[model samples]
Target: MAEQSLVFSFFLIFTGAAILATLALYTRQPLLVAYIVLGALLGPYGLSLVTDTALLADISHIGIIFLLFLLGLDMQPSHLLHMLKKATLVAIASSLIFMATGYGASLLFGFSQIEALIIGAALMFSSTIIGIKLLPTTVLHHRHTGELVVGLLLLQDVIAILVLLLLYSGNNEEQSGALAFLKTLAALPLMTAGAFLFVRYVLLRLLQSFDRFHEYIFLLALGWCLGMAELAQAIGLSAEMGAFVAGVTLATSPISQYIATSLKPLRDFFLILFFFSIGASFNLALVDAILVPSLVMTALVLALKPVVFRFLLIRISESKKLAWEIGFRLGQISEFSLLIAYLATSAALIGQEASHVIQATTILTFLFSSYLVIFNFPSPIAISDRLRKD
Candidate 1:
């Protein structure tokens, strides 16, 4: 906690993360898992090398805001409409299914109603970051498997945003549920129209005028993300949702890819810190209390989530194999799940033990998912061989 130790901790943690991430890449695993392991080793549970995790958590949270900004820059409304129905249906169905299963399992494990609900919602999201990163750029992503993954995860992101909104609204004592829900609902249209107008008139025009100025574009992108976040808070909506909406609004811009590419390094840096902070802040004492629930949740995610996703994709006109592949690739839990769980715990919407459960489940699913997706890439070929014999 001292000034010198604080400086030393930051350096050591990030350095360790960087080295482990490199090794992860060499071994064909996602860097996220590496980051989590680094956090576990350096965090309270392990070496206790870092003491000011709270400060790091706050700093890393800005990465979330920035990430949403870049995501918004690419998510133009017209683009969303192209696959709106499919995205909406898949996201809704899968999220509901996961929530119900997750909630039931949590209660069976002895969690309170509120904790169960919070953890259930947290379990509803799949890791877009890890999913996309693990996906093969040439075959799986461009083919049916990739599209299904994108559509399903896109839907989950929207639902996650909405869940965060509801949680934020439900926190206050005086606000009636109906009124709060109404307020949240009303803000959506206004937010959309405002963002649309901004993009159509302001952002696009600015890009045209300053296409060469990457620096200015970057600043504009950052402002757009945080600005929308602040605006959402002012209007009784969740800032996180606002940031995601902002990303979706910019989805169709020709400059979207450039913005994403340019900002990716920055995103990675923050995410490293963000995930590390997640591990460091974890309370080891609660691990014993939630171990069974965590394992149950992890099993559900690892075994059932992909099956649900695969079924949904098949129902929506995708090939069985591609759908199955997509499902397996995304079967793991996500970083967003951890963030929501943490927020719920911090806000007392969920219990501390529940937060630990989410953390453990997330890490478990992450490890297993990476292995299943990355190492099992050759399995699809084996499936084809079996079909040939049949």
Candidate 2:
């Protein structure tokens, strides 16, 4: 019966998603928003067709790992390093300004100091999925704007991982925060060394030997990605970071493009589940209580992020048009914000109200940002004929 229910739930989700996605395309709406709405309608808080969101969420997280892995595969090591170096100062400066904005706004809304701090931290990152999803692959993939956006997002991902580590450490009475920090610091070099050694000595040789077998190559790529992810988790680092490293190590391989192309549909499948899980997990009943503060914070994030990013990018010698485009492309709070809120609430570091506030704000930004990008820029689902690009 339990197995039957899980299968039934997936059937409903995919069926509903297809209908909604088609309607979204006809109506010139974002398909991501349609998936979220479908989840909200069918999930626990609504009609209750699917009640085990936690299980779905766990499965959906693999989507993020795959997303990061693909991102790494696309970037050559030298190009990635150059972009990171150029964007580091801009990323840091923009993050500090956004954090201060969030902190001040939360305090003004009567949140506790710790709650404000957590909220502020959550505001520091922009949505990687939305930013990359909306970008036209042909124009942005190798363009200057793409490089800057990717660089900043990568730095933010590192900061988010460290923040998560701190939250985890805080939950354990026996663990010293400094020790956790040092462990994470140490894990970077260790993971890099391990990835390179394995790729050079084992993975590349296997791929070379089995180059004729497409199916075998695909299995090997999945194995390599998941293996690194598990290894990273075994250490103090994040699985996403590890998956990225796995991809990076294989970036120079002749078969990297084949792997990337073959795995895209698989990646998209998991990502749909991920976006649905986001909507399914939220409880609308709690939103009313945090509505006022949440709206204020959301508005501030939507407005200030672009301005801050543009200013910083311009100051760092980026072109005005490029700066503005990158800024607007990143003008939304990240999915990591939702994760931070969940972790803080679970750890008893913040109240349910605060968590709800963060969730609501993140969703609001996701909705608006997607529309903004779709209407104004070149996207896969752009409303305008001229702006639509593959």
Candidate 3:
């Protein structure tokens, strides 16, 4: 089949999304879920209508970068630092528990040790896309909740960076590999400091001077966000992480709210594509082969993550209700999990079987965990009108 043009793909996706999203709302299901199902239906795996998976994936990622940038606009660096400090123990403890659960589940299905290792690593982190996208930011209760969720996710992103570094470094010479990875890791702090300086000495002044030029401010914000994202990638960190940093740098600026509000619509557009790309990229053919094992690991993660998080959080003196809410919000596997599967498979570290299992399980958990949060919590995409805060 010929690959669809970008314009045509957009048309198909939005048109299909509209129909499915209406059905989703009528049935009181999350709109994000509809986006996923539409991807599966029209994606190469389902109908082969949209065959340029790589392009779609790349374009869709801007959505995540924008999401993080917008999220940062609402936060203060001090609050983020404090929350990260307070939540460190919970993040570490919860990751270990979730890792063990995934390892055990993978081993139960007779996957090799390496396969289990990758799966376990993938399972430890929760979906930042879902965790933040669904979270409502305007409300008081949710604002507090957002701080905790963002903190834990940031910590988890650090761990994920380490894991990706390990995955890319390969296993030829353990000691040298570790040293080389550590060397690259040193760039993160330096880059962050540089970002602060750039934001303070350059970007803020531009924003202040151009505040009256709404169009210029919007373009400048986009340029700053994407420029930082690319720089972060060059420095061996994730683009989304860089986008978050860019947002946080401007968090103190007076125009942050305006920037955040303006970028939201564009963010939502890309996000729809992001979720659609996810379902499209999934191979339906492999689902049956990996289904049983994927289901096992999926159940373990979905069941244990929330409970373990809640337990650890309560032990750290977090209120019971809020802790439980955080737990469920973070109950799914992450997009990093999908990235790991792809990188691991490419590196020949894990076989197709294991990769499929990780991909399948991650998507499943995305589905389940999204439903769990939307139904029970206040989110921008909540099914209940009262719970919807956007």
| Highest lDDT scorer | 3
Per-residue alpha-carbon lDDT of candidate 2 for residues 1-390, written as tens digits (9 for 90 to 100)? 989998998998899999999999898899999989988999999899999999888888898888888877877888888999998998888888888988999899889999999999999999988888787656654366776788899899888988888888787755577788888888888898889998999999999999999999999999999999999988888788888899889999989989999988988888888888888988989877999998898889878888888888888898787787888899999989999999999899999988988998888899998988888777878999998886
- What TM-score, over all chains together, does every model reach? 0.84, 0.97, 0.96
After superposition, candidate 2 runs with Cα above 4 Å error: 140-142
Evaluate all candidate structures by whole-model CA lDDT and list the values in order. Answer: 0.75, 0.88, 0.89
TM-score rank order: 2, 3, 1
User: In each prediction, how many residue pairs overlap at the backbone (N, C-alpha, C within less than 3 A)?
Assistant: 13, 0, 0
In terms of TM-score, the best-performing candidate is 2
Better of 2 and 3 by lDDT: 3
* TM-score of candidate 1 against the unseen true structure: 0.84
Worst 10 residues of 2 by lDDT: 136-145
lDDT of 2: 0.88
- Error (Å) of candidate 1 at residue 269 is 0.7
Candidate 2, residue 293: lDDT = 91
lDDT, candidate 1, residue 298? 90
Q: What's the distance in Å from true for residue 283, model 2?
A: 0.8
197-223, model 3: which lDDT tens digit per residue? 998999888887878899999999999
Rank the models by lDDT, top first: 3, 2, 1
TM-score: model 3 vs. ground truth:
0.96
